[model samples]
Target: MTYTHILTRPVRFFGFAALAALLAAIIFAGAAFGTTVFAAPIERTDVLIGFKNIPGFAEHTLVRAHGGAVTKSFHLVPAVAASLPSAAIRALERNPLVSVVEIDGEFTAIGHSVELDNTWGVAHVGAGSVHHDSVVGTGIKVAIIDTGIDYTHSDLGANYAGGHDFVNGDNDPMDDNGHGTHVAGTAAALLNGAGVVGAAPEARLYGLKVLNASGSGSFSDVIAALQWAVDNGVSVTNNSYGSSRDPGTLVQAAFDNSAAAGVLHIAAAGNEGNCPGNRNTVGYPARYASVVAVAATDKNDKRPCFSSTGPDVELSAPGVSITSTYLGGSYATGSGTSMASPHVAGVAALVMAAGEQSASAVRQILRDTAKPLGDSNHYGHGLIQAVAAVAAVGDSSPPPDDSEPEPEPEPAPEEPTDEPDTTTAVVSDISYSTSGGRTNDRHLTVAITISNGDGAPIGGATVSIDLHRNGSRIASGTGTTNSSGVVSFTLKNAQTGCYSTTVTDVVAEGAQWDGFTPSNEFCK
Candidate 1:
């Protein structure tokens, strides 16, 4: 059976009527940011290999990897130049430590790389965290795989190192359907004075156009882009589009291969709702193994009518009336889960920034802290909260000595004997790793611990792992703590170097939430 768990909570405004009536007074309190409504698969190529024994690994062989547990092993060999796969496998079989081996690959969330320029949306998540201290995801490279992004926009120009259009097989990834541009802005718009801010202001953006100008393309183009990203050094790959059909054996294989190389693959849940005519309809890539599918929700924490629903949706974010950078140095507001996917991708970047978190850690933080929407079908978790995401990263990290003193403990209020006041919950003491490395069929293990403010162990708390390097995600996993409040997961067959890992605390809604954020503590 597949493992299932809840990762986020829905954002619920308690008093809509009262709030609306007082809107005039609160007009300047906070502007109503535009909202948009929108909205993974797991696999065995999904299994991380052990480090004890790897086949076909030779010294000096350049190999890419995803989540591996052991970094150093006796049987492990560095990437070396050699065409003798048969000889290498035979030689490895002769060794007692050699058990199994696979080629290294990357699976990253494709995103748009460009200059950071934005307002309402940019700093929403990455700013200020105890873990990362600085905003997470700054100056990271995120690859956008869709129609394309306008590479020359003033906001995106300076940050644009280079990108290619897989659709036309050229360097220009200009957006024709406007979908890619919109998605790009949401992920990494330059934080200049022009439009809005991106989830990662300091992130470097790369545009990989898999979709055509009409907002659609063949699966082959996407596969090609995936290969290109792997061949190049892209860390994250964000896909904001989807279809209801299977991506075919070849395409799925391509995705699997890429993930093995250590790139994160993020996708959008299709916009189709539960219509009577639909039959098992869900978004592609979203339904596929290892993908982080996203959904859409409004400010009220309700699903928009246009947003799709299903098991494929991994999380929810601001999908309605979202303001982002548009083509030609302009800004626009729009809706769709297509708009929501990038926000999560940006959060993934932030998670990577905070610590050496595996893909699973980033995904776990998103789900556990996600505000649960009343309409669970449409809003998978709830509206994605940037502050909360950043906070999750912060909570999992320890504060620097130079930082301000910890906040004084608040006095516990007297409890009413009648009907335990169930509205409060306590969350405290969070920590994680800032891991960034490549794998090569070697096992890499990360140790984690969790506890409550009273120093009691917090059992059953969930943690996420996101393995990323060069601005991409390789693999992800989620695990829960045992009675001891400690758990360990192995990253099998990794490439090596500069990988990140993160952990999070998921408290029930009825208790007070307290903890240090694990935003940024590791990333080299």
Candidate 2:
């Protein structure tokens, strides 16, 4: 969902209590000495700081010396969430150890109230048949990163493993707001024969409360929650909250790192749809390349006015008036891309439980088996079909074979020569270089090298690159590699900001292109 505008009000430093106590002591001492002492209030801003290297005690001490307090420190992403004086931000950005400094933007739950109704999404997405086949997402961990989950709810308690409350900084992640509970129910509610069941009724649920009762929270909290998910061995994360604004390199880095660690992230595309559906309205971290952006559809498989459409949207699911478990052991119906995301997540769990555990493999299986609807903008690969996806991995039971005539076995084909055909080619390295300082005069060049498995250069390979700045693809180019196995693409008049180049494809006549490890490079 599109977040409300970020909160810009000045905040007091995290050490304000200690500072006040010191001020009181100074005032008493000054009065005894027949003098008055005063301390100016420090106006701080919540920010996420990215480090060139993983931060340690020295870096934290530096922040404290500059009147900043570390709220959270991350291990995998090399970043820290802290509150610093507005004037100190520039100093930190200029620090040799710091890579980027950005204000922590706000994100919120995307769903709105709707009339109570039956849970039609499970059957609509073919989960009912899959459930009947006895593959109900058993032994899979799906983390719900939102307001929180009402684990005490009868339908969800059985699946609730445990959770952390980032908003309240505690272990109890109870949902004062109903959004997370409803979302959790749709993803992994229990099949206890009373209330509505989830798409993957047996998947374990972990509640990570990033947002508060008002359904809004800062980017720092979301990042910390994601880090927690990655650290705790979560298989998949259902992020039904987002902001239209780009959350800068720190958030993207967290998602990419988590994805690299085998955590599949699914998020809402947004509620900013249009009648024509021509605009790209997907929100971050959904817009990030590491996440699967989900679009919302109705019972008739029609895109709703509020469901955002974009190239980033990878899958669509039922979101309109879907009822699920709510706070206080109740149920509620809501509508938004938020409702659509958990459907995909639950199906993802089902596929994972059905013997496809790799995050990338599950993503491709879901895409390959989705029911296609016209217009990729409105419906990316159409609706997700749980049975087809599960069956694709050979997990579902086939129908019993009836009486049939025996047939002769076909002859086997001849074996090929031991050594022939193409050699395997892979991207050896990708590097970035920049020139010029003025806004309109800046230029960026990306060089990619391809080589074989033995590290020999693969010449004449066609390489394609997508140039991204600030998380959006701005330009793309294709060129053949030189005899030295290097292909360089330059963007003239590139704006000064975070830049990255991804090798979309590599082709050669006598060499098969094996996938390479992907990484990002920045010019700023």
Candidate number of the best TM-score = 2
lDDT of 2: 0.79
Q: Write the per-residue lDDT of candidate 2 for residues 206-280, one digit (tens) a residue.
A: 899999999999898888888778767788999999898998988898899999999999999999888789899
Clashes of each: 169, 0
Candidate 1, 112-155: lDDT as tens digits = 22343223433333232322455546545578888788776776
Residue 17 of model 1, lDDT score: 80
Candidate 2 residue spans exceeding 4 A from truth = 1-38, 394-524
Candidate 1 regions with alpha-carbon error over 4 angstroms: 1-133, 274-280, 394-524
Query: lDDT of each model, Cα atoms only?
Result: 0.54, 0.79
Pick the lDDT winner. Answer: 2
Weakest lDDT window of 10 consecutive positions for candidate 2:
1-10
Ten contiguous residues minimizing lDDT sum, candidate 1 = 73-82
Q: What's the true lDDT of residue 30 in model 2? A: 44
TM-score of each: 0.51, 0.70
TM-score of 1: 0.51
